[model samples]
Target: MEDQPEHSVSNEKSTAVGERQLHRGDYGAETELQRHLSTRHVTMIALGSSIGMGLWLGSGKSLASGGPVGIFLGYILAGSMVWAVSHSIGELAVLYPLPSAFVQWTGKFVSPSAAFSLGWAYWFNYILTVANEIQVTSVVMGFWTDDLPNAAWITIFWAVVTLANVFGVKVFGEIEVVGASIKFGWIIVVIFSLIVTSAGGAPGHGPIGFRYWNSDPFTHGFKGFLSVMPTCIFAMAGSENCGLVAAETRNPRRSVPRAVGSIWLRLSLFYILGAMMVTINVDPHNKDLFGQSGTNASPFVIAYREARLPALAHMMNAVILISVVTTGTIYIYSGSRNILGLAHLGMAPKQFKHADDSGRPWPGLVLSIILGGGLAYLNVKNSSADVFSWLSNMTSLFTLFGWGMICLAHIRFRHAWHAQGRSDSDLPWKSWTYPYSAWWGLIWCMVLIVVEFYLAVWPLGLPPSAKNFFSNYVSVIAIVVLYLGARTYYRGPWWIKLTDIDLDANRRFYVDTEIEKVPEKGLRGKAEKVLGFLFN
Candidate 1:
């Protein structure tokens, strides 16, 4: 947070000079952010961000509110939204390869005021996510014992994440690759365990073949289904962080597309199918599904506990702890870069843009730690489940709003491309679904936001609570205030004209370089290709 820059009038020509003047002051000439992340590193970063606590801990609430069928549908709808937004972001990032990703694009393609809202909104989203990850990590630890306080565990992992991010992008990327690989393997184990236990393969369980669904498919009916949308949105929040790191990757043109391409597989295998298995093995109406102590909240753990498999339950909890801590590291890495991007665009203080020789934005990193890490102390005063509920609600709302803006920015970019007489063949990587996918993402995201509004007003089986209403809708209110305040201070237009949009700034790096493709030839090559296909 820095003071707003004073607005100034400029010419309305199609030249770079006019465009740069219209978008705050000229873009900062120096950007010391290094491109150190490899293809594998970037791919797993995307995977690691999305495959964390939302599925492990928060799914209990989803299943409790909406039964088996309701939660399944929620995952499908939310997965589709993530897919559409991923392609939109992929196409834009490959073309622009800029420092801030879609946040800066809103200023260039839409308006400066919109970019101001997006940049700060996205930064805050990650900050809240940081706290959410920490709280959940403590909850996961409860599965073992409550020997130490949640606050003690919070401080320990906070230091771990902070140290990981402080060393620069290379260190962070390496850690993510390892952490994400472990998580990937653990999910496969969980899915297989669920399959086995559901078929009566465990010691003391009868066959569980859709028995829960037969009893009650939809727990609370249509309203209950609507209530799960926000949690679904929260579950998929970090998938977009892949494209945001384009500026820090070694070869964004190749790495970003690979990362984006694999998102569909991740969603289908990890989220959608994972939901199906959870509902099959664990009863949605079980009282253990609503545990507030976090010890028995995860349906996956509950399923194993009921099946007489304590050892497996313990193993699953251990991996969940690792996954939560890994996610915390990602939020800090992404949050710092977001603020750095804001500074580069002249939307924040110049000092925030400062980077060390190793390309670490120390100032922004410190601020992220203070604000995001500080929020974890809320668990000291309230139950872990209560803290998780409100934090997830707030973060999910912000994510849905940010996603809608991303799709809008993409649509506007296409308009500007055609208006400037640019050919589609000149593009390095094209979004196969173009206008249709962008529209799909935009409309559905808006609908989900509206669903969030409805659920906030009347929570599942309870009257409207002032605390609940604000906890869920505060993200919407904050963004509106940020947008109006920036717009008033800058005296900018509501939207940029298509003909005057700046489509060429910071794009020469991607447009001028030829895409080099290496052919696969030997055993090593084949092995590498298989790994790339699976991860990248």
Candidate 2:
């Protein structure tokens, strides 16, 4: 990744450049990351990150508030918007395939102030989230013993996940692949178990099928549905990490879309349907379903026990412990890459973008650890339940805004791409549903967020509490504050015109146009093509 002389991208050339190595990026001078993550790496990362504490722990909130049916509806609806956003970001990300996905694009496509807001907002969102995940790990471990203090467990997990991220992208990818695969397989098993247990197939139960669903499909009605949204929002928030890893991924144009395209199907089967299974098997009135009992309180675990599988429930609890740590490791890396992206935009100091010999973002990782790792210590004095509640309210809406920004920026980028006389097919991955799809995602994400906010802060409903009001709406206030602050400090135009964007800036130094088009002449080629289509 030594400096290969910088070259400008040709405007007349097509946007779809096929699979290629990434040496330079649209990010400023510090684009020395080693492109090593494969399609499986990113796909699993997308899958694994989404299946974190949200499903393992937060499902309690979704079920307790929304009940089975309401929570399922919430996930499916929110997931649809995220699905559109995935395609939107995939199309734009392949253009530059840089770290932090939609972050730097705002500067060139929208305005400098806007880009600053998106970049820092995304960075803080993940970094702080990583800290919260670590705190939850200490709480999850408490399922086994209270012998060790929360601080000790927090320190241990903080160091382990930090090293995993700093070890390099390859190491990070391998961990996620294994962790996510296990989680996926476990979900499938849990689904089967739920079906069986509900059918009176287990030892103690006698055909509980549809009993819970028929009795209490909607817990708190419409307001309850809104309450579960933050949990669903947090569950669906991590898919964008696929795009954030673009700069360090091989053949992003192919890998990113391949990963992004699968998000909806995964959510349908894993999240929405998984919750449906819990509804069929577990009683909505169960106190443990609220996640107050830590790992033991997980609906998945309780579902296993309902089937007379206590040992299996405990084992799944152990698996959840590993999944939490794995996800925390990935977010730490992702957050740092975002910081590196900011440096590339010259929005932050150059040191944050520095890379070591293995293409590890040393400075960025250190900063993430300093901030995220330090914040994890909050679990020492406060309870994990309280910390999780605060973190959830603060961050639930943040990444939704990130997705909205991606759609908005993509709308602008598409207009500019067409205005320059470029056909949609010329792009590596044109969002076929473009303009309409992006608008659909952008508008709904905003509307749902507004409605959810009102549900939380509304005077009549929900228990009156400062935590409810502040935690839920603080992110909105923070975004406005950051935008105004950036606008004042940067003092730039409100929006950059489509024609003026430096499309030529930071084009990858390497390109292989024949990546997907290579002929399948030999048997080896045919197998490779099939595998490529499956993964690439």
Give the winner by TM-score: 1
All models: lDDT? 0.81, 0.76
Query: Tens digit of lDDT per residue, candidate 1, span 1-536?
Result: 13443332222222233245554434432388887776777777877777778888778888988889999999999999999999988988887766667787777787778888989988999999999888666778777778989899889888889998998888988888888888877888888888999999999688998999999999899998888888888987888888778877767788888888888878987899889989999888778774433345688889889999999888877877888888989999888888888898878888899889898988889999988889988888887777878888888888987888889999998888988999888788888888898999999988877888888898887789997789778998999999998776566457888887656666635545555344468863563476676754
Q: Residue-pair clashes per candidate, as listed?
A: 0, 2
What residue pairs clash in candidate 1, if any at all? none
RMSD in order of candidates: 4.3, 7.2
lDDT of 2: 0.76
Candidate 2 regions with alpha-carbon error over 4 angstroms:
1-26, 291-296, 459-467, 508-536
24-47, model 2: which lDDT tens digit per residue?
Answer: 224553377888776667777877
